[model samples]
Target chain A: MSMMKIGGWIKRILVLIFALVYLAPLYIAVVNAVKPYDEIIKSPLTLPKQFTLNNFVEAYQSSNMLELYKNSIVITVSSVALLILLTSMAAYIIARRKGKVYQMLYVFSLAGIMIPPVVTLIPSIKTLSALHLLYTMPGLLLFYAGTYFSTTIFLYVGFIKTIPASLDESAFIDGANPFTTFFRIIFPLIKPCTATAIIFLGMWIWNDFLNPMYILGFRGGKTITTGIYNAIGAYTSMWNLVFANVMLASLPIIILYLCMQKMFMQGLTSGAVKG
Target chain B: MKHNKLYDTLFLAPGFLVYIIFMIIPVIMCFLYSFTNWDGISASFRFIGLKNFVNLFQDASFFQALKVTLIIMVLTTLIYNILGIILAALLNDTGKLLGFSRSAIFIPTVLSAVVVAFIWSYVMQTNGGVINAIIEMFGGTKVDFYATPMTTIFMISGIICWNSLGFFVVIYISTLTTIPQEIYEACKVDGAGWFYRFFHITLPLLAPGITINCILSVAGGLKQYDHVKVITGGGPGGATQTVTLFGVEKAFEYNRRGYSSAAIIILFIIIVIFSIVQLAISKKHEVEY
Candidate 1:
C-alpha cells in the first residue's frame, strides 16, 4: 500500500512537470510579446521588468489585423457553410438510396480524401483564371469546396446512416417535398454531425496557410495566416513584434478551442478515426 | 420509399460540379500538363513527351527534395506515434494534473502551423534564442539550428512533431479508453509489471489507432510546407525544400509547369502507395474486439 502511494505521488508530480514543459513555448510567446525589445534580448526567460501593449498596437496596425480578420472570417464562414449544406444534402441522398449510381457517387466523393490539395493547386490555378476567379476569395472558397467535399460528405454519410429512414418517411407523408424534408427535418436531427463538421472544417479553413497564400496571392486580400507571415517576415528580428503578431493571429482560435475543448477533440477524433 | 431522381440529381449536382471542375478536372489536367512544355503564362506550348519525368529523374535538386521529404516523414511519424503512445499512457488517468497536461499539449495543435513555426523560430534562434539563452546561462555553446541543410530539416521535423504530437496523443488516449479494464486487471493478476502489461495488453489493443495516426502523420509529414516555409522559405538555394515547396517554386517562379506537375504527381503516387500498404498491413493485424 505504501509503495502504491509513493508511485501515485511520483506520477502526479511528473505529470505536473510535463505540463509546465509543454506550456513553456506559450509562456515564451506571451511574456516576450509584452516586453521591450532590449528586455527580450537581455533575459527572455525571466519575468518582464515592465510590460506594455505597444507591441500589440504596432503588430495590429502593421499587419492590417482588421482586414485579415475580415478576409479570414469571410472565407472560413462561407467555405464551411457551403461545405456543410452541399455535403449534407449529397450525403442525405447517398445515405437513403440504395442503387448503383448512389454507390458510385459515394465512391467518387471519397476520391478527394486521399489527394492532397497541393496536387490540384497548380491545375486549379489554370481553371480559376479561365473562370476569372483566380486570386479571389470566391476562388479559394470553390477550391476548398472541391478539396474538402470528400471528407465532409464521408462524415455526414456515416452519421446520416445511423439516423433512421422513418423520419424522412414521416416528413414526406406530411406533404413535404424532398428538399423541404431534408432542410427542415433531417438537417436538424444531424446537429451533432454538423457540429462535428463545423468544428473540423472551421479550424481547417481558418488555419489554412498554403492554399490561401497561392490562390489569393498579393493583390487579393490576405487571410490571417498569410498576412501574419508577410508581416512577420519583415520583422523577423523583432521578437516582440513577432510574438505580438503571433498572439493576435492565434488568440481567437485558441480561445475558441478552450471554450469548446470537448467538442473540438470529439470533432477532430471523429473525423479522423471514422473517416 | 421511392426516390425522386430529379431531387437526388439536384442535391448532388452543385457539389459534384465544384468537385469535378476544381478537383477532378485539375488532376486530369495535371497529368496532361506533365507532357507539355507550357510556361504558365504561354498561350501555346509544345508537346514534350516524357521530358519532365525524364528530367526529374536526373535532377539532383529534385532527388534532394525527395530525400528531405522522406526523412522528415519518417522522423515525424516515428516521434508522433512513439512519443504519443507513451504520453497517452502516462496521462490516461483522470486527475487534474493529467487533464491540465493534456490540455497544455493540445493547445499548440489548435494554433496555426504558421504561428507555431514562428514561435519556435524565436525559441530556436542562435543569438539570444530562448533555448540558447538558457544554455548560455549555464555556460554552454549556442547551437545553430540552420548550421546545415540536414540539421535544419531535422530541427524543423522536431518542431513539427512538437506542434502536432498532441493531436496523435489525443487519438491514442481515446483509443486507450475503448480498451476494457479487465484486460489490464487480468495482466496485473498474472503478476505482469507495467512494462509487461503495456507491451502485452495496451500495445496490441492500440493497433487500430496506430494505423490511423501513422497514415495521417505520414501523409501530413510528406506534404510538409508551412513550418519549413516560415522557418527557412526553402532558402540557402532550396537546401531543405520538400517536394511540394520545390514543385510550387518551379511552377510559379521558374515557369516550369510541366516539371513541377511531374514532381507533385510523384508525391501523390508515393502517398497513395504508402497509404495502400499501410491499410493492407493494418487489416492483417487488426484485432477484432
Candidate 2:
C-alpha cells in the first residue's frame, strides 16, 4: 500500500513539472508584457518589479484592436454560420437520399477534405478577382465556406445518420414538406452535432491567418491574427509591445476555450475519431 | 417516402454552387493554369504544356523549398505523435494534477500560429531571450537559434510542434479513454510490466487515433506557412522557405502564376501520396478486437 501511494505521488509531481514547462512560454509572455523594456532585458526570467498596463494600451492603439475584433468577429461568425447551415442541409440530403448521384455528390464533397487550402488559394485569387470580390471580407468568407465544406459535411453526415429516418418519415407523414420536416424536427434534434461543427469551424475560422492574408489583401480590413502580425513586424525588438499584441490576439479565444473546455475537446475529437 | 426532386435541388444547389465555384473549380483551374505561361496580371497567355513542371524540376530554389518543407513535416509529425502519446499516457489519470496539466498543454493549441510563433521567437531570441537568459544565469553560453537557415528551420519546426502537440495529446487521451480496463488488468495479472502492456496492448488499441493524427499532422505540416512566415518570412535568400511560401512568393512577387501553380500542385501531390500511404499502412497495422 505504501509503495502504491509513493508511486502515485511521484506521477503527480512529474505531471506538475511537465505542466510548468509547457506553460513557460505563456508565463514569459504574460510577465514580460507587464514590465518595461529595460526590465525585461535585465531579467527576462524574473517577476516584474512594477507591473503596468501601458503595454496593453499602446498595443491596442497600434494594432487597432477594435477594428481587428470587428473584422475577426464578422468573418468568423458569418463563415461558421454559413458553414453549419449549408453543410448541415447538404448533409441531411446526403444522409437520407439513395442513388448513384447522391453517392457521387457525397464522394465529391469528401474530396475537398484532402485538397489543402493552398491548392485552391492560388486559383481562387483569379476567380475572386474576376468576380470583383477580391480583397473583401465577403470574399474571404466564401473562400472559407468552400475550403471547409468537406470536413463539416463529413461530420454532419455521420451524426445525421445516427438520428433514425423515422423522425423525418413521421414529419413527412404529418403533411410537411422536406424542408419543413428538416427545419422543424431534424435540425433541432441534431443540436449536439451542430455544437461540434460550430466549435471546430469557429476555432479554425477565427484562428486562420494565411487565407485572410492573401484573399483579403493589404487594402482589405485586418483580422486579429494578420493585424497583430503587421503591427509587430515593424517592432520586432519591442518585446513589451509584441507580448501585449500576442496576448490581445489570443486572450479572447483562450478565455472562450477555458469556459467551454469540455465542448472544445469533445468537438475537436469527435470530427477526427468518428470521421 | 418518394424522393422530391425540388427539395433535393433546393437543399444541395446553394452549398454545391459555392463549393464548386470556390473549391472544386479552383482545383481544376490550378491544374489548367500549370499548363500555361500566364503571368497572373495578363488576361492572355499561351499554353506551355509541361514547361512549368519541367522548369520546376530544374529550379534550384524549388528543390530547396521542397527539402525544407519535408524536413519540417517529418520532424514535426514525429514529435507531435511520439511526445503526444507519452504525454497522454502520463496525464491519463483522474486527478487534479492531470486535469490541470491537460488544460495547460491544450491552451497553446487554441492560439493562432502567428501568435504562438511570435511568442516562441521572443523566448528563443539570442539576446535577453527567456531560454538564453536562463542559460546565462547558470553560467552557460547562449545559443543563437537563427545562426543558420537549417537551424532556424529546425527551431521553427520545434515551435510548430510545441504549438500543436497539445492537440495531438488531446486526441490521444480521448482514444485512451475508449480502451477497456480489462486488457491492462489482465496483463497485470500475468505479471506484465508497464512497458510490456503499453507496447503490447495500449499502442495497438491506439492505432486508430494514431492514423487520424498522423494524416492530419502530415497534411498540416506540409502546408505550414503561418508560423514560418511570422518567424523568418522564409528569409536569408529563401533558406527557410516552405513550398507554400515559395509558391506564394512566386505567384505574388514574381507574378509567375503558371510556375507557382505547378509548384503547389507538386506539393498537393506529395500530401495526397503521404496521406494515402499512411492510411494504408495504419489500416494494415490496426488490430482487430
Candidate 3:
C-alpha cells in the first residue's frame, strides 16, 4: 500500500514535468509575442514589463495581414464546403454498399489515405496546368478534394455505416431524390461527420503551405501561411516583427480551437481511429 | 435502381475522377518520371531506366536528406506517442486545470505549419530568441540552436512534434473517455500497481489509438516539409533537407522533374513498408475486449 502511494506520487510529478516540456514552445511563443525585442532576448521566460503594439502593428502592415486573413478564410471555407458535399455523398453511397463494386469504390477512395501530399506536389503542377486551374482558388479547391478525398471520405463512411439505412429508404418513399435525401435528411444526421470535416479540413486547408506556395503562384492572393512566410523572409533578422507576425497568423485558429475544444477532440479521435 | 446506378455514377465519378487524375495519376507519373532525365522544361526526355536511382544512390545530398528524414520520423513519432499517451492519461479527468491544458495544447495543432515554423524560429533565434533569452536569465550561454544543420534539424523536429502532439493527445483523450471506468476499478481491486495497470490494462486497450497515432505520425513525419522549409529552407547546403524537401527542391527549384519523381516514389515505398510493418506489429498486440 505504501509502495503504491509512493509510486503514484512519482508518476504524477513525472507526468507534470513531461507536460510542461511538451508545452514549452507554446508558452515561449506567448511570452515573446508581447515583449519588446530587446527584452525578449534578455528575458525570454519572464513576464512582459510593458505591453507594446508596434511589432504587431508593423507586422500587420508588412504581412498584408488583412488580405492574408481574408484569403485564408475564403480558401478554407470554400474547400471545406466542396469537400463536405462531395466526400459525404461518396461516403453515403459507399457506406450503404455491401457489394463488391461498392466495396471496391469505397476502398479505392480510402487508398488516398497513404499517398503523402509531397508525392503529388510536383505532378499536381502538371495536372493543374493541363486543367488550366493552376494558381487559382478553384484549382487549389480541386487539389484539396483530391488530397483529402480519402481521409474525409473515410470519416463519413465510418459514421454513415452506423446510421440506419431505413431512414434513407423511407425518405425516398416520401418522394425524395437521392440528393435530397442526402442533403436534407442524411446530411443533418451526419452532423458528427460535418463537425469532423469542419475541424479537420478547416485546420488543414487554413494551415497548408506547399500547395498554396506553388499553386497560388506568389501573386494576387496569398493565404495566411505563405503571406506570413514571405513577411518573415523580408524581416529575416527582425525577431520582433517575426514574433508579431506569428501571433497575428495564429490568432484566429487558436481562438476557434479554444472555443470548440470538445468538437475538436471528438472530430480528431473519429478521424484518427477510423482511418 | 436506375436512379441508384446513376447517382452512384454521377456522384462517384466527379470526385473520384478529380482525385485519381490529380492525386493517383500524378503519384504514378512521379514514379515513372523519376527514372528518366527530364528537366521538366524539355519537350521530351528519354527513359534513362535506373540511372536516376543510381544517381540518387550516389548523391550525398540524398543520403543527408534520408538521415535527416529518418531522424525526424523516429524523434517525432517517439515524442508524439509517448508524450501524447501520458498527457491523455493525466488530463483525462475533468477539472479547470486539465480542461485548460487540453484546450491549450490542442490550439497549436490547428495553426498551419508555416505559422508554427515562423513562430518557433522567432522563439528559437540566438540573439533575441525567446529560448536563449530564458537560458541567459539563468546565466547560461545563449546557444544558437540553428548554427549547425544537425542542431537546427533537431530543433525543427522538436517543434514539429510540439505542433502535432496536441492533435494526438486529443485523440488519445477521446479514446480514453471511451474506456470504461469499471475496468480500472476492477484492476485496482486486484492490487495492480500503476505500472502494471498501465502495461496490462491501459496499453492493451489503447491499441486502436496506438495504431492510428503510429501510422499518422510516421506519414506526417515522413512528409515533413512545410515547417522545415519555412524554418531552414533546407539550408546550410541542404544538410537539414528531408526527402520531401529534396524532392520539392529538385522539381521546383532545379526543374529536375524526373529526379524529383524518383525521390517521391522512394518515399512512397518507404511509407508503405513502414505502415505495413507497424500494422502487423500493433495488430499482434491487440487484446480483444
Candidate 4:
C-alpha cells in the first residue's frame, strides 16, 4: 500500500515536470519579450534584467498590428458567419429530406474533405483572377467558403440529423415557413454545433498562412499570420522583437482558448470522434 | 409543394453555387491545368499530355522534398501518437494539476503555426538559443539544430509535434472517457496488472480513436507547409522543402504553373492513397466494443 502511494506521488511529480518542459517555449517567449535585445542575447533562459515594453511598441508599429488585426477580424468574422448561415441552411435540407438528390449533394459537398487545400490554391488563383476578385477580401472569403465547405457542412449535417424532425414539423404547423422554422426553431438548438464550427473555422482562418499569403496578397492586406511572418522576416535574429511579435500575435487566441477551455476541448475533439 | 422545390433551391443554390464555381470548378480546372504548359500569365497554352508528370519524376529537388516530407510525416505521427497516448494516460485523471497541465499543453494548439514557428525558431537557435543555453548551464556542448538538412528536418518535425500534440491527447482522452469502468474493474478482479489492462483492454477499445487520429495525423503531416515555410523558407539550397513548398516556389517564382499543378496533383493522389490504405488497415483492426 505504501509503495503504491509513493508511486502515485512520483507520477505526479514527473507529470508536473513534463508539463513545465512542454511549456518551456512559451515561457522563454514571455520572459524574452520583456528583455532588451542585448539582455536576451546574454541570457535567453533567464528573466529580464531590465524590463521593457519597447519591443511591443516597436513590434506593434513595425508589423502594422492594428491593420493585421482588422483584416483578420473582418475575414474570420465574415467568413465564419457566412459559412454558418449557408452550411446550416443547406445541411438542414440534406439531413431532413430523403432523396437521391440530397444524398448526392451530401456526397458532393463532402468531396472537398480529402482534397488538400493546396491542390485548389494555384488553380483558384487563376479563377479568382479571372473573376477580377484576386487580392480582395471577398475573394479570399469565397475561396475559404469553398475550401472548408465540406468540413463545416459535415459537422452541421451530422448534428442536425440528431435533432428530431418533429420539432421542425411543429414549427411548420405554427405558420412558420421553412426559412422561418429553420432560423427560429432549428438554428437555435444547434448552438453547440455552431460553436464547434465557429471555433474550428475561426482558428483555421485566423491562423491560416499559405492561402492568405497568396489569396490576400500584400495589397489585399496582411492577416496576423502573414503580417508577423513578414515582420519577423525583416528582423530575423532580433530575438526580443521576434518574441514580442509572436506574443502579440498569439496572446489574443490563447486568451480566447483559455477563457473557453471546455468549449475549445469539445470543439477540437467533436469532429474527431465522429470520424 | 411547388414552393417547397423553390425553397430547397433557394437554400442550396447559394452555397452550392459558390461551392461549384469556387470549389468544384477549381478542382476540375486543376486537373485540366496539370496537363498544360500554361505559364499562369500566358493567354494561350498547349495541353502537353503527361509531360509535366513525366518531368516531375525526374526532378531531383522534387524527390528531395518528397523524402523530407515523408520523414517529417513519419516522425511527427510517431511522436504525436506514442507520446500523445502516454500524456493522455497521465493527464486522464481529474485534478487541478491535471487540468492545468492539460491547458498548458493545449495552449500551443490555439496559437497560429506562424507564431509557434517564430517562438521555436528562436528557442532552437544555436548561439543564444534558450535550448542551447540550458545545455550549456548543465555543462553540455551547445547543439546546432540546423546543422544539416536532415537535422533541420528532424528539428522542424519536433516543432510540428509540439505545436499540435495536445490535439491528439485531447482526442485520446475523450476516447478514453467512452470506455466503461466495469471492464477495468473486471480486469482488476481477475488479477490483471496495469500493463496487462492497458495492452489488452485500453488498446483494443481505443481502436476507433486510434483510427481517427491516424487518419488525421497522416493527412495533416503530409499536407505540412506553414511551419516549414515560416521557419526555414525551405532553405539551405532548398534541401528542406516539402512538396507543397516546392510546388509553390515553382508556381510563383519559376512561373511553371502547369508543372506546379502536376506536383500538387501527385501530392493529392499520395494523400488519397495513404488515407485509403490506413482506413483499410484500421478497419481490420477496429474492435467493436
Two-chain DockQ for each candidate model: 0.77, 0.81, 0.59, 0.76
Compared with the true structure, model 4 gives a TM-score of: 0.98
* CAPRI quality band, candidate 1: medium
Model 4 regions lying over 4 Å from their true place: A1-3, B1-3
Worst 10 residues of 2 chain A by lDDT: A266-275
Candidate 3 docking class? medium
Chain B TM (all candidates): 0.98, 0.98, 0.96, 0.98
Candidate 3: lDDT of B280?
96
Write model 3 residue lDDT over A64-90, tens digit each, in one string.
Answer: 899988898999899999988888888
DockQ of 1: 0.77
What is the lDDT, from 0 to 100, of the residue B17 in candidate 3? 82
Which consecutive 10 residues in model 2 chain B have the weakest lDDT in total? B128-137
lDDT of 4 by residue, B17-63 (tens): 88887788888888898999999998999999999999999999999
Error of 3 at B40 (Å): 1.6
lDDT of 1 by residue, A1-275 (tens): 89987897799889789878878999999999999999998889888899899999999999999999999999999999999988899899999999798899899889988998998999999889999999999999999999999989999999999998999999888889998999888999999899989988898899999999989997889999999999998978999999999999988888988999999888777766753
Query: Candidate 2 — which residues are off by over 4 angstroms?
Result: none
iRMSD in angstroms, per model: 1.4, 1.2, 2.6, 1.5
Query: Model 4: C-alpha RMSD to truth?
Result: 1.3
Kindly report the fnat of each predicted structure, to 2 decimals.
0.81, 0.84, 0.73, 0.80
The sequence of per-residue lDDT tens digits that candidate 2 reaches over residues B80-147 is 99999999999888988889899999999889999999999989989877888888879999999999
Pairs that clash in candidate 3:
A207-B112, B34-B262
Candidate 1 lDDT for residue B167: 92
